[model samples]
Target chain A: DAGITQSPRHKVTETGTPVTLRCHQTENHRYMYWYRQDPGHGLRLIHYSYGVKDTDKGEVSDGYSVSRSKTEDFLLTLESATSSQTSVYFCAIRPDRRNTEAFFGQGTRLTVV
Target chain B: AQSVAQPEDQVNVAEGNPLTVKCTYSVSGNPYLFWYVQYPNRGLQFLLKYITGDNLVKGSYGFEAEFNKSQTSFHLKKPSALVSDSALYFCAVRDIGIPGGYQKVTFGIGTKLQVIP
Candidate 1:
Protein backbone atom coordinates (compact mmCIF):
# COMPACT_ATOMS: atom_id res chain seq x y z
CA ASP A 1 0.00 0.00 0.00
CA ALA A 2 1.32 3.41 -0.99
CA GLY A 3 -0.77 5.43 1.40
CA ILE A 4 -3.64 5.42 -1.09
CA THR A 5 -7.29 4.88 -0.20
CA GLN A 6 -10.34 4.58 -2.41
CA SER A 7 -13.69 5.19 -0.80
CA PRO A 8 -16.76 3.00 -1.23
CA ARG A 9 -14.99 -0.17 -2.30
CA HIS A 10 -18.28 -1.34 -3.77
CA LYS A 11 -21.11 0.77 -5.06
CA VAL A 12 -24.41 0.34 -6.91
CA THR A 13 -26.24 3.14 -8.64
CA GLU A 14 -29.16 3.47 -10.99
CA THR A 15 -28.67 4.29 -14.63
CA GLY A 16 -28.76 8.00 -15.43
CA THR A 17 -27.90 8.83 -11.85
CA PRO A 18 -24.83 10.75 -10.84
CA VAL A 19 -21.87 8.99 -9.18
CA THR A 20 -18.58 10.11 -7.85
CA LEU A 21 -15.60 8.01 -6.79
CA ARG A 22 -12.88 9.37 -4.56
CA CYS A 23 -9.17 8.65 -4.47
CA HIS A 24 -7.11 9.91 -1.59
CA GLN A 25 -3.37 9.63 -1.30
CA THR A 26 -1.07 10.48 1.58
CA GLU A 27 2.22 10.26 -0.28
CA ASN A 28 1.76 13.74 -1.76
CA HIS A 29 2.75 12.50 -5.18
CA ARG A 30 2.46 14.93 -8.05
CA TYR A 31 0.76 12.49 -10.42
CA MET A 32 -2.52 10.65 -9.89
CA TYR A 33 -4.68 8.63 -12.24
CA TRP A 34 -8.09 7.00 -12.44
CA TYR A 35 -8.61 3.85 -14.46
CA ARG A 36 -11.41 1.41 -15.13
CA GLN A 37 -10.80 -2.30 -15.57
CA ASP A 38 -13.02 -4.63 -17.53
CA PRO A 39 -12.83 -8.14 -18.78
CA GLY A 40 -11.17 -8.51 -22.21
CA HIS A 41 -9.88 -4.95 -21.75
CA GLY A 42 -7.36 -4.61 -19.00
CA LEU A 43 -7.10 -1.19 -17.46
CA ARG A 44 -8.34 1.80 -19.40
CA LEU A 45 -7.31 5.22 -18.24
CA ILE A 46 -10.27 7.46 -17.49
CA HIS A 47 -8.37 10.52 -16.34
CA TYR A 48 -5.06 11.57 -14.84
CA SER A 49 -3.87 14.57 -12.89
CA TYR A 50 -0.31 15.75 -12.98
CA GLY A 51 -0.76 18.40 -10.36
CA VAL A 52 -3.46 20.01 -8.27
CA LYS A 53 -6.27 21.33 -10.47
CA ASP A 54 -4.48 19.97 -13.55
CA THR A 55 -6.05 16.98 -15.24
CA ASP A 56 -6.21 15.33 -18.64
CA LYS A 57 -8.41 12.74 -20.34
CA GLY A 58 -7.36 9.30 -21.48
CA GLU A 59 -8.40 7.03 -24.33
CA VAL A 60 -11.86 6.33 -22.86
CA SER A 61 -12.69 9.57 -21.12
CA ASP A 62 -16.11 10.06 -22.67
CA GLY A 63 -18.95 10.79 -20.22
CA TYR A 64 -16.47 10.78 -17.33
CA SER A 65 -15.03 13.82 -15.60
CA VAL A 66 -12.38 14.27 -12.91
CA SER A 67 -11.41 17.06 -10.56
CA ARG A 68 -8.34 17.38 -8.35
CA SER A 69 -8.85 20.26 -6.01
CA LYS A 70 -6.09 19.26 -3.61
CA THR A 71 -2.95 17.25 -3.78
CA GLU A 72 -4.40 14.29 -1.90
CA ASP A 73 -7.80 13.94 -3.50
CA PHE A 74 -8.73 13.14 -7.09
CA LEU A 75 -12.42 12.74 -7.79
CA LEU A 76 -13.96 10.95 -10.77
CA THR A 77 -17.51 11.85 -11.61
CA LEU A 78 -19.94 10.11 -13.87
CA GLU A 79 -22.41 12.79 -14.90
CA SER A 80 -24.97 10.21 -15.89
CA ALA A 81 -24.26 6.64 -14.99
CA THR A 82 -24.86 3.98 -17.61
CA SER A 83 -24.65 0.20 -17.66
CA SER A 84 -21.53 0.46 -19.76
CA GLN A 85 -19.84 2.48 -17.02
CA THR A 86 -20.06 -0.37 -14.53
CA SER A 87 -16.59 -1.66 -13.93
CA VAL A 88 -13.75 -1.91 -11.42
CA TYR A 89 -12.15 1.48 -11.00
CA PHE A 90 -8.61 1.89 -9.73
CA CYS A 91 -6.74 4.96 -8.54
CA ALA A 92 -2.99 5.17 -8.88
CA ILE A 93 -0.27 7.53 -7.73
CA ARG A 94 3.35 7.98 -8.70
CA PRO A 95 6.17 10.42 -8.23
CA ASP A 96 7.29 12.82 -10.94
CA ARG A 97 9.98 10.45 -12.05
CA ARG A 98 9.22 8.55 -15.23
CA ASN A 99 11.15 5.45 -14.27
CA THR A 100 9.18 4.91 -11.09
CA GLU A 101 6.21 2.55 -10.90
CA ALA A 102 2.73 3.62 -9.93
CA PHE A 103 1.12 2.54 -6.69
CA PHE A 104 -2.52 1.43 -6.87
CA GLY A 105 -5.44 1.46 -4.50
CA GLN A 106 -7.60 -1.51 -3.66
CA GLY A 107 -10.04 -0.53 -6.43
CA THR A 108 -13.70 0.43 -6.50
CA ARG A 109 -16.22 -1.91 -8.03
CA LEU A 110 -19.20 0.05 -9.32
CA THR A 111 -22.37 -1.30 -10.83
CA VAL A 112 -24.97 0.74 -12.68
CA VAL A 113 -28.31 -0.91 -13.12
CA ALA B 1 1.79 7.24 -27.88
CA GLN B 2 3.23 4.26 -26.02
CA SER B 3 1.32 0.99 -26.02
CA VAL B 4 1.75 -2.48 -24.58
CA ALA B 5 0.30 -5.83 -25.63
CA GLN B 6 -0.18 -9.15 -23.90
CA PRO B 7 -0.95 -11.60 -26.66
CA GLU B 8 -1.99 -14.56 -24.51
CA ASP B 9 -5.27 -14.55 -22.65
CA GLN B 10 -4.10 -17.35 -20.37
CA VAL B 11 -1.08 -19.56 -19.77
CA ASN B 12 -0.93 -22.85 -17.92
CA VAL B 13 2.12 -24.42 -16.34
CA ALA B 14 2.64 -27.27 -13.93
CA GLU B 15 4.36 -26.78 -10.62
CA GLY B 16 8.18 -26.68 -10.78
CA ASN B 17 8.10 -26.04 -14.50
CA PRO B 18 9.43 -22.92 -16.08
CA LEU B 19 6.84 -20.34 -17.13
CA THR B 20 6.72 -17.31 -19.33
CA VAL B 21 4.15 -14.64 -20.16
CA LYS B 22 4.53 -12.69 -23.39
CA CYS B 23 4.44 -8.91 -23.71
CA THR B 24 5.27 -6.60 -26.61
CA TYR B 25 5.33 -2.85 -26.76
CA SER B 26 5.66 0.01 -29.24
CA VAL B 27 7.20 3.37 -28.53
CA SER B 28 9.03 5.97 -30.53
CA GLY B 29 11.85 6.55 -28.03
CA ASN B 30 13.28 4.86 -25.01
CA PRO B 31 10.46 3.13 -23.16
CA TYR B 32 10.10 2.45 -19.47
CA LEU B 33 8.52 -0.96 -19.01
CA PHE B 34 6.91 -2.53 -15.98
CA TRP B 35 5.17 -5.70 -14.83
CA TYR B 36 2.51 -5.95 -12.19
CA VAL B 37 0.51 -8.80 -10.72
CA GLN B 38 -2.96 -8.86 -9.23
CA TYR B 39 -4.47 -11.42 -6.95
CA PRO B 40 -8.21 -11.97 -6.68
CA ASN B 41 -9.99 -8.96 -5.24
CA ARG B 42 -6.81 -6.96 -4.71
CA GLY B 43 -4.99 -4.11 -6.37
CA LEU B 44 -2.09 -4.49 -8.76
CA GLN B 45 1.37 -5.07 -7.28
CA PHE B 46 4.60 -3.98 -8.89
CA LEU B 47 6.81 -6.85 -9.95
CA LEU B 48 9.71 -5.42 -11.94
CA LYS B 49 10.74 -2.70 -14.34
CA TYR B 50 13.10 -2.16 -17.27
CA ILE B 51 14.56 1.30 -17.44
CA THR B 52 17.92 0.93 -19.17
CA GLY B 53 21.20 -0.97 -19.09
CA ASP B 54 20.88 -4.75 -19.00
CA ASN B 55 18.16 -6.40 -21.00
CA LEU B 56 17.35 -8.78 -18.14
CA VAL B 57 15.65 -7.28 -15.10
CA LYS B 58 14.59 -9.10 -11.93
CA GLY B 59 11.92 -8.20 -9.47
CA SER B 60 9.83 -9.44 -6.58
CA TYR B 61 8.56 -13.02 -6.21
CA GLY B 62 11.22 -14.86 -8.15
CA PHE B 63 10.24 -13.26 -11.44
CA GLU B 64 12.43 -11.77 -14.13
CA ALA B 65 11.79 -10.17 -17.51
CA GLU B 66 13.98 -9.90 -20.57
CA PHE B 67 13.75 -6.70 -22.54
CA ASN B 68 14.61 -7.09 -26.20
CA LYS B 69 14.75 -3.79 -28.03
CA SER B 70 15.14 -5.41 -31.45
CA GLN B 71 12.03 -7.53 -31.00
CA THR B 72 10.14 -4.86 -29.05
CA SER B 73 9.25 -7.33 -26.36
CA PHE B 74 9.56 -7.70 -22.61
CA HIS B 75 8.70 -11.25 -21.65
CA LEU B 76 8.39 -12.30 -18.01
CA LYS B 77 10.11 -15.49 -16.96
CA LYS B 78 10.30 -17.69 -13.91
CA PRO B 79 12.62 -20.56 -13.32
CA SER B 80 9.93 -22.63 -11.62
CA ALA B 81 6.23 -22.10 -11.32
CA LEU B 82 4.26 -22.48 -8.14
CA VAL B 83 0.58 -22.77 -7.47
CA SER B 84 0.75 -19.55 -5.51
CA ASP B 85 2.04 -17.76 -8.57
CA SER B 86 -1.29 -18.07 -10.36
CA ALA B 87 -2.75 -14.64 -10.92
CA LEU B 88 -3.48 -11.93 -13.44
CA TYR B 89 -0.40 -10.17 -14.80
CA PHE B 90 -0.24 -6.82 -16.56
CA CYS B 91 2.43 -5.18 -18.67
CA ALA B 92 2.72 -1.41 -18.75
CA VAL B 93 4.87 1.11 -20.66
CA ARG B 94 5.80 4.76 -20.40
CA ASP B 95 7.61 6.67 -23.12
CA ILE B 96 10.15 9.11 -21.78
CA GLY B 97 10.60 11.11 -24.94
CA ILE B 98 6.96 12.07 -25.30
CA PRO B 99 6.32 15.77 -25.69
CA GLY B 100 4.42 16.43 -22.49
CA GLY B 101 4.93 17.35 -18.89
CA TYR B 102 3.56 13.95 -17.89
CA GLN B 103 3.91 10.60 -19.53
CA LYS B 104 1.02 8.28 -18.79
CA VAL B 105 1.62 4.59 -18.44
CA THR B 106 -0.44 2.41 -20.76
CA PHE B 107 -1.24 -1.12 -19.67
CA GLY B 108 -1.90 -4.24 -21.70
CA ILE B 109 -5.03 -6.35 -21.61
CA GLY B 110 -3.43 -8.67 -19.01
CA THR B 111 -2.68 -12.38 -19.04
CA LYS B 112 -4.04 -14.94 -16.60
CA LEU B 113 -1.37 -17.34 -15.30
CA GLN B 114 -2.44 -20.67 -13.90
CA VAL B 115 0.18 -22.72 -12.13
CA ILE B 116 -1.17 -26.19 -11.53
CA PRO B 117 -0.23 -28.24 -8.54
Candidate 2:
Protein backbone atom coordinates (compact mmCIF):
# COMPACT_ATOMS: atom_id res chain seq x y z
CA ASP A 1 0.00 0.00 0.00
CA ALA A 2 3.05 2.25 -0.01
CA GLY A 3 3.08 2.59 -3.76
CA ILE A 4 5.53 -0.34 -3.84
CA THR A 5 5.04 -3.15 -6.33
CA GLN A 6 6.75 -6.52 -6.73
CA SER A 7 6.45 -8.48 -9.92
CA PRO A 8 5.84 -12.22 -10.49
CA ARG A 9 4.31 -12.87 -7.11
CA HIS A 10 4.97 -16.59 -7.58
CA LYS A 11 7.83 -18.14 -9.53
CA VAL A 12 9.46 -21.54 -9.99
CA THR A 13 12.83 -22.06 -11.60
CA GLU A 14 15.19 -24.94 -12.26
CA THR A 15 18.21 -25.34 -10.10
CA GLY A 16 21.29 -23.44 -11.34
CA THR A 17 19.10 -21.18 -13.50
CA PRO A 18 19.05 -17.44 -13.35
CA VAL A 19 16.18 -15.48 -11.82
CA THR A 20 15.42 -11.90 -11.05
CA LEU A 21 12.82 -10.23 -8.87
CA ARG A 22 11.85 -6.65 -9.48
CA CYS A 23 10.76 -4.01 -6.99
CA HIS A 24 9.32 -0.70 -8.21
CA GLN A 25 8.35 2.21 -6.04
CA THR A 26 6.54 5.49 -6.65
CA GLU A 27 7.31 7.13 -3.30
CA ASN A 28 10.83 8.13 -4.35
CA HIS A 29 12.25 6.88 -1.08
CA ARG A 30 16.01 6.86 -0.76
CA TYR A 31 16.24 3.36 0.75
CA MET A 32 15.13 0.04 -0.78
CA TYR A 33 15.75 -3.45 0.62
CA TRP A 34 15.51 -7.09 -0.50
CA TYR A 35 14.87 -9.83 2.04
CA ARG A 36 14.15 -13.54 2.13
CA GLN A 37 11.81 -15.12 4.66
CA ASP A 38 12.15 -18.72 5.67
CA PRO A 39 10.64 -20.79 8.42
CA GLY A 40 12.52 -20.38 11.73
CA HIS A 41 14.73 -17.72 10.15
CA GLY A 42 12.36 -14.80 10.06
CA LEU A 43 13.35 -12.34 7.35
CA ARG A 44 16.99 -12.19 6.38
CA LEU A 45 18.29 -9.28 4.36
CA ILE A 46 19.61 -10.16 0.92
CA HIS A 47 20.68 -6.74 -0.16
CA TYR A 48 19.68 -3.08 0.03
CA SER A 49 20.20 0.19 -1.75
CA TYR A 50 20.55 3.47 0.06
CA GLY A 51 20.53 5.61 -3.04
CA VAL A 52 20.58 5.24 -6.77
CA LYS A 53 23.50 3.01 -7.73
CA ASP A 54 24.53 2.65 -4.08
CA THR A 55 24.09 -0.85 -2.71
CA ASP A 56 25.27 -3.08 0.14
CA LYS A 57 25.13 -6.73 1.07
CA GLY A 58 23.05 -8.03 3.97
CA GLU A 59 23.13 -11.01 6.28
CA VAL A 60 22.13 -13.51 3.60
CA SER A 61 23.61 -11.92 0.51
CA ASP A 62 25.56 -14.90 -0.72
CA GLY A 63 24.60 -16.28 -4.15
CA TYR A 64 22.43 -13.21 -4.72
CA SER A 65 23.09 -9.86 -6.34
CA VAL A 66 21.17 -6.62 -6.62
CA SER A 67 21.29 -3.56 -8.84
CA ARG A 68 19.69 -0.15 -8.51
CA SER A 69 20.04 1.83 -11.69
CA LYS A 70 17.32 4.36 -10.90
CA THR A 71 15.49 5.57 -7.85
CA GLU A 72 12.30 3.80 -8.84
CA ASP A 73 13.60 0.29 -9.52
CA PHE A 74 15.69 -2.22 -7.61
CA LEU A 75 16.36 -5.69 -8.95
CA LEU A 76 17.39 -8.84 -7.07
CA THR A 77 19.19 -11.40 -9.16
CA LEU A 78 19.94 -15.00 -8.39
CA GLU A 79 22.97 -15.78 -10.49
CA SER A 80 22.49 -19.47 -9.92
CA ALA A 81 19.50 -20.72 -8.09
CA THR A 82 19.60 -23.52 -5.56
CA SER A 83 17.12 -25.51 -3.55
CA SER A 84 18.40 -23.84 -0.41
CA GLN A 85 17.56 -20.47 -1.91
CA THR A 86 13.84 -21.16 -2.09
CA SER A 87 12.03 -18.69 0.11
CA VAL A 88 9.57 -15.83 0.19
CA TYR A 89 11.23 -12.65 -0.99
CA PHE A 90 10.08 -9.23 0.13
CA CYS A 91 10.95 -5.75 -1.00
CA ALA A 92 10.78 -2.79 1.33
CA ILE A 93 11.29 0.95 1.20
CA ARG A 94 11.47 3.76 3.73
CA PRO A 95 11.92 7.49 3.77
CA ASP A 96 15.37 8.84 4.58
CA ARG A 97 14.28 9.90 8.03
CA ARG A 98 15.96 8.13 10.93
CA ASN A 99 12.85 6.67 12.52
CA THR A 100 10.38 6.34 9.67
CA GLU A 101 8.76 2.93 9.41
CA ALA A 102 9.67 0.73 6.45
CA PHE A 103 6.84 -0.30 4.16
CA PHE A 104 6.75 -3.66 2.37
CA GLY A 105 5.45 -4.86 -0.96
CA GLN A 106 3.55 -8.07 -1.55
CA GLY A 107 6.12 -10.85 -1.25
CA THR A 108 7.38 -13.04 -4.07
CA ARG A 109 7.33 -16.77 -3.38
CA LEU A 110 10.15 -18.38 -5.33
CA THR A 111 10.82 -22.06 -5.66
CA VAL A 112 13.93 -23.73 -6.99
CA VAL A 113 13.60 -27.27 -8.21
CA ALA B 1 25.87 -5.27 14.76
CA GLN B 2 22.18 -5.05 15.65
CA SER B 3 19.81 -7.95 16.22
CA VAL B 4 16.37 -8.76 17.63
CA ALA B 5 14.93 -11.89 19.19
CA GLN B 6 11.39 -13.16 19.65
CA PRO B 7 11.84 -16.06 22.05
CA GLU B 8 8.45 -17.59 21.60
CA ASP B 9 7.58 -19.33 18.38
CA GLN B 10 3.87 -19.17 19.11
CA VAL B 11 1.47 -17.89 21.74
CA ASN B 12 -2.14 -18.79 22.42
CA VAL B 13 -4.72 -16.70 24.19
CA ALA B 14 -8.47 -16.70 24.69
CA GLU B 15 -10.68 -13.95 23.38
CA GLY B 16 -10.98 -10.98 25.76
CA ASN B 17 -7.83 -12.00 27.56
CA PRO B 18 -4.72 -9.89 27.69
CA LEU B 19 -1.89 -10.96 25.37
CA THR B 20 1.76 -10.26 24.98
CA VAL B 21 4.48 -11.23 22.50
CA LYS B 22 7.94 -10.72 23.88
CA CYS B 23 10.90 -9.23 22.02
CA THR B 24 14.46 -8.37 22.99
CA TYR B 25 17.13 -6.54 21.04
CA SER B 26 20.82 -5.69 21.17
CA VAL B 27 22.49 -2.74 19.50
CA SER B 28 25.03 -0.06 20.20
CA GLY B 29 23.90 3.43 21.22
CA ASN B 30 20.22 4.31 21.23
CA PRO B 31 18.16 1.73 19.38
CA TYR B 32 15.03 2.46 17.38
CA LEU B 33 12.57 -0.37 17.91
CA PHE B 34 9.49 -1.40 15.93
CA TRP B 35 6.68 -3.95 15.86
CA TYR B 36 4.93 -5.20 12.73
CA VAL B 37 2.13 -7.65 12.09
CA GLN B 38 1.42 -9.86 9.09
CA TYR B 39 -1.82 -11.49 8.12
CA PRO B 40 -2.15 -14.60 5.99
CA ASN B 41 -0.50 -14.15 2.58
CA ARG B 42 0.08 -10.44 3.17
CA GLY B 43 2.99 -8.11 3.74
CA LEU B 44 4.02 -6.84 7.14
CA GLN B 45 2.33 -3.68 8.47
CA PHE B 46 3.66 -1.23 10.97
CA LEU B 47 2.13 -1.60 14.41
CA LEU B 48 4.18 0.74 16.62
CA LYS B 49 7.63 2.15 17.16
CA TYR B 50 9.84 3.30 20.02
CA ILE B 51 11.99 6.14 18.74
CA THR B 52 12.42 8.59 21.58
CA GLY B 53 10.57 10.33 24.38
CA ASP B 54 8.00 8.16 26.13
CA ASN B 55 8.96 4.59 26.95
CA LEU B 56 5.42 3.46 26.20
CA VAL B 57 4.36 3.66 22.52
CA LYS B 58 1.06 2.74 20.94
CA GLY B 59 0.07 2.12 17.35
CA SER B 60 -2.37 0.43 14.97
CA TYR B 61 -4.95 -2.13 16.08
CA GLY B 62 -4.82 -1.25 19.76
CA PHE B 63 -1.29 -2.58 20.11
CA GLU B 64 1.37 -1.08 22.35
CA ALA B 65 4.99 -1.81 23.18
CA GLU B 66 6.97 -0.96 26.27
CA PHE B 67 10.58 -0.04 25.82
CA ASN B 68 12.94 -0.91 28.69
CA LYS B 69 16.46 0.38 28.17
CA SER B 70 18.10 -1.60 30.96
CA GLN B 71 16.56 -4.85 29.82
CA THR B 72 17.04 -4.06 26.13
CA SER B 73 13.50 -5.14 25.47
CA PHE B 74 10.45 -3.86 23.57
CA HIS B 75 7.54 -6.18 24.13
CA LEU B 76 4.25 -5.86 22.22
CA LYS B 77 1.11 -5.94 24.30
CA LYS B 78 -2.65 -5.79 23.93
CA PRO B 79 -5.21 -5.27 26.65
CA SER B 80 -7.76 -7.72 25.23
CA ALA B 81 -7.36 -10.26 22.50
CA LEU B 82 -9.67 -11.01 19.61
CA VAL B 83 -9.85 -13.82 17.08
CA SER B 84 -9.09 -11.31 14.37
CA ASP B 85 -5.81 -10.54 16.10
CA SER B 86 -4.34 -13.92 15.19
CA ALA B 87 -1.34 -13.42 12.96
CA LEU B 88 2.42 -13.49 12.74
CA TYR B 89 4.24 -10.68 14.52
CA PHE B 90 7.78 -9.46 14.12
CA CYS B 91 10.08 -7.21 16.11
CA ALA B 92 12.81 -5.12 14.57
CA VAL B 93 15.56 -2.72 15.59
CA ARG B 94 18.02 -0.26 14.11
CA ASP B 95 20.75 1.95 15.49
CA ILE B 96 19.42 5.48 15.52
CA GLY B 97 22.70 7.15 16.34
CA ILE B 98 24.45 6.24 13.11
CA PRO B 99 23.40 8.11 9.97
CA GLY B 100 23.63 5.05 7.73
CA GLY B 101 22.24 2.69 10.33
CA TYR B 102 18.66 3.56 9.48
CA GLN B 103 18.93 2.05 6.02
CA LYS B 104 18.01 -1.42 7.28
CA VAL B 105 15.94 -2.73 10.16
CA THR B 106 16.95 -6.18 11.37
CA PHE B 107 14.04 -8.46 12.14
CA GLY B 108 13.53 -11.26 14.65
CA ILE B 109 12.06 -14.66 13.95
CA GLY B 110 8.32 -14.02 13.92
CA THR B 111 5.96 -15.26 16.62
CA LYS B 112 2.61 -16.64 15.53
CA LEU B 113 -0.29 -15.52 17.70
CA GLN B 114 -3.47 -17.54 17.93
CA VAL B 115 -6.45 -15.98 19.62
CA ILE B 116 -9.22 -18.49 20.22
CA PRO B 117 -12.83 -17.53 20.59
| Interface RMSD, in order shown | 0.9, 1.4
lDDT of 1 by residue, A53-96 (tens): 99999889999999999999999999999999999999999887
Candidate 1 residue pairs in backbone clash? none
- Top candidate on DockQ is 1
Q: Which model scores highest in TM-score?
A: 1
Per-structure clash totals for the candidates: 0, 0
* Candidate 2, A1-113: lDDT as tens digits: 69999988999999999999999999899999999999998998889898999998998999999999999999999999999999999999988756788899989999999
* Residue A82 displacement (Å), model 2: 0.7
DockQ in order: 0.80, 0.72
Instruction: Give the lowest summed-lDDT range of ten residues in model 1 chain A.
Output: A94-103
Model 1 stretches astray by more than 4 angstroms: none
